[model samples]
Target chain A: MTKFTTRLPLIGIGVFAVLLLVVAPAVLSEHWISNLGKYCCLAIAAVGIGLAWGRGGMLVMGQGVFFGLGAYAMAMHLTLETAGPGALPGFMILYDPLAPLPAFWEPFRSEVFTLVAIVLLPVIVSAILGYALFKRRVKGAYFAILTQALAVALAVLISSTIRETGGDTGLSNFKYFFGYVLNDEANKLMVYLIAAALLVVCLLAVWQFNRSRFGELLVATRDAEERVRFLGYDPANIKLFAFVVAAVMASIGGAMFVPIVGIITPQEIGASASILMIAGVALGGRASLFGPALGAMAIGWGQSSLGSSWPEGWIYILGLIFIFVILFLPMGLSSLFDRAKGLIRRSSDEPGPATPELREVVK
Target chain B: MSVPDASLVVSDLHVQFGAFVAVHDVSFDAHPGEVRFLIGPNGAGKTTCIDAITGLSKGTGTARFGDKELLGSPAQKIVRLGVGRTFQTASVFAQLSVLQNLDIAAGLRRSPVSLLRARRGVDASVERALEETGLGTVRDLPAGMLSHGQKQWLEIGMLLVQDAKVLLLDEPVAGMSQDERTATGELLGRVAANRVVVVVEHDMDFMRSFATRVTVLHQGRVLSEGSVAEIQADPRVQEVYLGTAGALSGALAPGAEEVD
Candidate 1:
């Protein structure tokens, strides 16, 4: 069963990647290819959220804090490279005149520095926050509220730091990524492939972690924290490890989002964005292996297609989807397919050989 | 005997919730290899005493396991120091399979850094604990799907896997059927062979079977302490149990021995 579950996701991802690489260019326009890249970024964040919130039972509302950290780090480097030395970036000149670049933004001039910051900054922040929260034994709704507050605070701080953070407009209008012109069609396809490849890697990492002993301890902490404590394990430490990993994943997703989507706005790393990540995970089934990534991508696609046609009604559509998922499909879309398969197997099975005791025990 | 090298020693332990003292200046020594019963009426601070011993609640005075002080340590720290406990509510990992639950409990004693790299097989300790609790049959099933009696036994299995020198159990057989209770009593007898076992219970019949010595508490103080029969005949115990000294003396006169 474990082998089947592990292989199923790998096969699904391989087939999807092949389809995107071989057939997407013929079927989808350049704009749609760009949209697919954006969806892949959201799916990456969803996979992280699923690990922390879905399986680990942490209601992380401030995944945006890590996301923002990564986005800002990448955006800073891009803005600096585009502006050249000694000249202010376009947004900086618009927001504040005659002000030097912030000291923290100085190191991002080198691509290596920016890449390292994208991963390290989120990890450091998550480690600190997780240490404080988990060591104090916070869980359930309190954890959700704490993380949400972090998202709100980070967004507000970024918005208020007009000169450095580009205020509400954010840094955008990128011309190149790794010397490849962003406007070129081949470069766009490369971005999509990179996002798709990263998503598959993240899924595999999470899948392996879930099968490991840390995963068992995490699930145990989620279900019965007191029992875990009495067994000579600190539930806080177990939870903290999972939470930090999730935060780093979200940060990497946010970093990718900046280049693929050509924007780094506060709105993309705020309360709404965090909630959207959660909604996708819940709609897809948080605990199911591929649910969060698939669900987030689906939502991202819907927003691009449906929101464009009916901007005012897209949120309503998303809300309705959430309500439907929570009501009828408590186990999410994964269970729907599972139930279908079960029904098919039941119809074909012999009745006389089945034992009632076995059914009761299994149930 | 001269304390018999107690694994758990509580000296004048006092617990309070704001102004109300729930467990007041209670002290007892649970010797290694003895099953000690803490019996009391409802709201008589049996649970509070257990909480203080396990370091789950802050209390004044001293709780020591061997040479280490348990007063300021966290519950997890106390468990690591050779003390394990079960909740009154049967707190097993409801989402994990029975086998997974045992593995986690056993894995706790292992280094957290190496927990992920541990080989995938039931440790000998976990297997022995599961067999002792008679939960070997349904070990593959999720704990949430177990019957109420089975859940209680699974919790016992978890405690056994912890391998603590002192095991504190709060109402180990509170809601079990007759057969289940008998089985649980037998399990406790086997577990008490090498470790110090302290059980808080309201059922007098169940307490009398496993306890070598029993301590009775009333209004957060030790009302009496001795064998079950000795404490049952004490006048103060009579007043607390029968609600009147005269009624208790009358009830204990003739056929109490046959009932006991």
Candidate 2:
């Protein structure tokens, strides 16, 4: 059983890699390609959420803070590049009129600075928050509430900072990314590829972390903090590391999201957005390798398709899905697929603990 | 074998909750490597004394870990200083695997941050701790699924990982089957080989089997301290046990006649 579990991950990864890298590009249409790219970025964020919430048992509701940091950083760079020397980005000029761009925004014009900020901002914020909260021994509902509050506050702050942050409208309408025109089909595909590649990398990183000693400790910390403490570990530190890693992943997703979606709005970095990320993670299977990424992407696709025809009803659909997933599928969608496979394997072998429904199907 | 000093000295220890005094001017020492049984009828500060020693509760008492002052130190610090403990209720991380529980407990002695990213060597220690507490088979199973007795053993396994010089166990066998009680008694006897083990217990059978010395507390005061027979034979203990002198003598009269 252990051998099968070990081999199954490798097989799954290989199959997924082939499908994503080879088949996806060959079969998907330009529009679908762009959409897939957007989902990929979301998947990255979901991966992080999975680590923090699923593995570490921290309900981090304020991932948007890091997401916003990455998005705004990338958005700032794209805006500055389009504006040229000495001229402010369109939103800054419209909102503030006479004000020069914030000094902090100056560095983002450089691609390297923008890239670094996308990763570093989330890591730094998460580290600080994780350190403080974990050190104080805050866990369970309190940690969840605190993270949610942070997300809420960040969203409000971004929305209110009309001059600097582009307010509720947010920074959008990018012409070029690096040198490629973002409007071009090829460029869009490239962005999608980048998002896909990053998502894969993030998954691999998390998988490796999970296999590592730290991963075991994080689970331990979640389950038996005092025991871990007695063993001589500060559970706070273990939890903090996982939390910060999750935050950084969310930030990277948000950064990539701006380019692929061609928009960065205050709405995407708000409480609702954070909840949406969590919903996807929960729906997918919080602890599973592909659950968060696939779950987030699936939700992203759902919102894009269903949201257009029924704007008000889309949120209700998501809510309903979340409720159903939690109620019927505690292990998330992954377990359902595993159960199906189990039934198939058992049919070829002998009878096992098959449910009445499964037995009927088998017969 | 000559025993080391088992003295647990607490000088001017004070604990307050806003304006409530939980422990006041409490001073006592259990000799090293001794099964010091702290027996109190109820609310006699038995658990409080253990908590103060393990630094779980805030107390203004100088709890000495050998020669070092344990006052103002965090619970983890106290554990590191060779003072291991268990809670009144079984406190195990229910969601984690049993092996993972021991791993975390063993890993607790190291910097979890560095250990989190690395995944070797810690397993051996965890396995050893598990072996010590006889939780080897269910190591892969989730701790939440463990029986209550198993959970208690797992908690003890966590303590073993700390390798503390002193173990402060609060009601170690509060809820257990007859077999579990016997197994636990045997386990504690094995554990007492190297450390100062202080147990707060209500089960006289469990305590009498292993306790080298017993300290009885009544209404936040030391009632008596001696061997099991010596303390059990005391008139005050008899009064406390029977609830009245007349009742105690009446109960003993039948036993006295049988012995005669």
Candidate 3:
């Protein structure tokens, strides 16, 4: 069972890289490329979900808090970049013409600071949150609900702070990204490439983690936390690490979401959005390495295509699929492949009467 | 008696849940190189005693392993202090292979950075644990798929790989057949050669065969402490065992002198 996570799907990864880097760019128009970029960011976040929820048994329902942090961080810097040096953003000027730039927004003017904030912001917040939650051993549904509430709270806070954060309208209309013109087709592709490349990097990192000793410990902790404690490990620390990593990954996805989608709204990093991310992960086989990413991308594609045709009805479709997966294929759609293989290889999946451990005990 | 630095000395331990005291001033000492047994009828507080010693439950009084106090420290800290325990139901990592379970247990001294890389080859300690537990043939099989007795051995093997100086196993042979029970006894004999092996059990036959020393507990306090032969001959143990468990088959040792 664990062999799926341990074995690196080399051919699959190579094909994915080609499609993301080469084939898609050559064949598709810019509109679809931009859509794929959004999906890429979502997929990046899903990989982390797989690690946290799938492997570590942490149902991190408030991942959008971290996503919001990264997206807003990147958006603030870009908004400031569009405002020119020493000038307040246009929204602040519109809301209060004489108001000074918020102190928190001032530091984002520096490119280095913006870059650091993308990763560090989520790390610090998640470190605190994870330390508190995991130390108390808050788990399962309670942990999930607590995290989801945080995302809602953050969204509400952002919604109310119209001047400082642009509130519900969010931060957009970015003319430049790190001195590069966002309007340029080549620059747009470059941003897309960056997001795509980062998704690949995240997948590789998680792959390494899945096969590593930490991965085994994470699984052990998930399956039987007390057993892990008896094995001389502080389960809190193990859980904290996975949760923080997942948060950071979500943050990175949000940061990338800004440059790709050209917007960072509270709606994108709220409770509903966070649930959507989880929906994708659960749709994919959460336990497998590529499941969450593939699942998220599939969901993204569905939203763009089927959603365009029937916006209200698409949600029903998603709900039905979710219910079906949860009921029959709890492992997600990826397990469908396993099921097919099981039908072909009937008897191989189960240990037969020949296992020496069974034979010796029987004798 | 003076307790050695390597011994697990649990003295006057008191554990309470609300107003009811589960373990009321129970005391016993287990040393390396012997298999210690804690035997009692149902609700005897034997499980509570080990739970407190392993820091799974809060308790008063001193349960010491070397210089470190076991009662106040956390579960992982007690484990780090070289004490390991197993649950009554065999709490091995069900989804992981036996080898993976042992690998995770043997990683006490591993650095966080090194854990990021995949394991290249099995550690000598893990290999030794596989050999010791007799799970070598099924090392790659998931622990959940193992036979009931094998899961118990795997749990013990996990502790062995951690190099735990003291092992507290709760009902290690509770669900085993006669053949499996003898095999487990032999395994415990080999494991106790250079460590403190403390077992909380109810099977009188396995206890008589494997226990180097026995402590009987009734209702939360220690009733008797002595060698297996001495405990068997004690009239007090006879009254507790025969009085409460005479109707229950195999709760008393075979061919013991009946109260006459």
Candidate 4:
């Protein structure tokens, strides 16, 4: 029984992989497959949130900053690829036909640099930001506000810098991905497959983190910061590590978002975007292995369907549900699995000896 | 065995919160092979003095654990310097199992890369801590489910797994039953074999039974320091801990509070 229970996670992830990589594409239409791929991108970001906000106890409200970094990096490369050598992205040409491509945007033209930036940008930014905030023991609402402020600041900065960042509309109209036509049906499917596969990889990584010693320490830090310090761990450093990991995940999600969605805007990697990511994780179960991913997909589905029909109503409904979950189901919908398991165990063992009951009490 | 046989010495330790001096003019030295007890009234600054020594508070003092200066260092730095502490309330990782709590404490020496891997089995030190604290049976149980006394033991177990040279415990036996208190006293005796075990407790009986050396603090100042008998016989400790002529009766009698 114990072995079975322990293997549940491995089994769960296996099932999830099959559902995503094998079953979904086989059954779903092309459009739905693309939508699922987009949802997978958001789900990737949600996995990171689970680690940072849920397990590490750092409520990260500005994940959009990291997401924006990845999205912009990928978008820049794709945009430059579309424009070809010597020519500029359409927006840059529209603003000033003769103005040479900015020196900063020049490096992103390399596929290697863009790919590395998608991973490294968030690592660097989050490391600096995390070190500054955590070293000072800044946490709770202050940390949330600081992160949200950064996302808001980035959005404002992008909106104001039209010539530099294409203003608010963001860099769009991508033609190719890694030199392949992104608009081609097969290539589009490949991009969706990439997103789906990456989601699985993210899940596997987070699952490993959840069971590791570092994962244990992250949780210990979350529950008892001072105690962890007395145990010879700098709580700030632990939090910083989780924050960096989360940032990278959000970045990957953003990077994937561009090719699948075919757009990169300030609005997509801003305060609302970050909060929406959090909302999905919270709704699904921030602490559980599969909760954040499933929750994100659900939110994505809602946005594509219910949101498009009654946009204002969707906002109100999402708000109400979030408030409800925060108030009553702080662990989110995923805790229901644990609760159900507990019930089954109790009911099954009712007529047994008092030994298991005693163990249950002790547990 | 680094800096072996070193004593934890605190001299002229003064801690202030703005205008309020929490611990002023306090000095105490605890050597390995002795279980030191710091006993005082509610506001006597027993916890405060340890706070300064463990880098949790700002104070003007020289707290030397072996050759290392504890003051001015960060909390984790102080811990890394082989100083571990427990809070007044039992503060174990309630969500984790008793074994996991010890594992995390023992993780100080673990490499960053090693921390990424899950435990293959119980670590030697963690196993020893579980045996010492009598938590082996409940090793897999979440700390929250443990009895109150078990939680306190788990906290001590954490310090033990940390291999702390100086264990500064705050009210480790506040709500324990007589049996649990005895078990804890024995555990401390075993732990203090080659480490400085300093306990800040209110239980006079527990102190008299286990403390090899005693320091009595009153109003942020050291009132008395000696063997257990010497502290009990001191008129000042009696007066501060009790009151007036009742000091004489309170010191010798079992019903110290009633006499006061």
Best by TM-score: 4
True contacts kept of each: 0.66, 0.64, 0.84, 0.82
Candidate 4 chain A weakest ten by summed lDDT: A353-362
- DockQ for every prediction shown: 0.51, 0.38, 0.59, 0.70
lDDT of 3 by residue, A270-354 (tens): 9999999999999998998889999999999999899999999999999999999999999999999877865655456355555
lDDT agreement with native, every candidate: 0.82, 0.78, 0.89, 0.89
For candidate 2, give the DockQ.
0.38
Q: Is the docking of candidate 2 incorrect, acceptable, medium or high quality?
A: acceptable
What lDDT tens digits, residue by residue, belong to model 2 across residues A226-263? Answer: 66676556678778888888988888899899988888
By TM-score, the better pick of 1 and 2 is 1
What C-alpha lDDT, on a 0 to 100 scale, does residue A321 get in candidate 2? 87
- Rank by TM-score, descending? 4, 3, 1, 2
Quote model 4's TM-score for chain B.
Answer: 0.92
Question: By lDDT, highest first, what's the ranking?
Answer: 4, 3, 1, 2
The sequence of per-residue lDDT tens digits that candidate 4 reaches over residues B1-260 is 22344789899999999899899879999998999998887778888998899888898979888888899999989998899999877898989988899999999999999999988898899998888898898888788878989999999988889888899988888778899989999999999988999998778878878999999888899999999889778888777766765452332332222100
Give me the runs in candidate 1 sitting further than 4 Å from their true place.
A1-27, A94-98, A345-357, A360-363, B1-6, B117-119, B244-260
lDDT of 2 by residue, B70-113 (tens): 87888777777777888766888776677766766665546535
Off by over 4 Å in 4: A352-357, A360-363, B1-4, B245-260
- Candidate 3 lDDT for residue B170: 89
Residue-by-residue lDDT tens digits, candidate 4, A70-162: 999999999999999878999998889999998989999999999999999999999999999999999999999999999999999999989
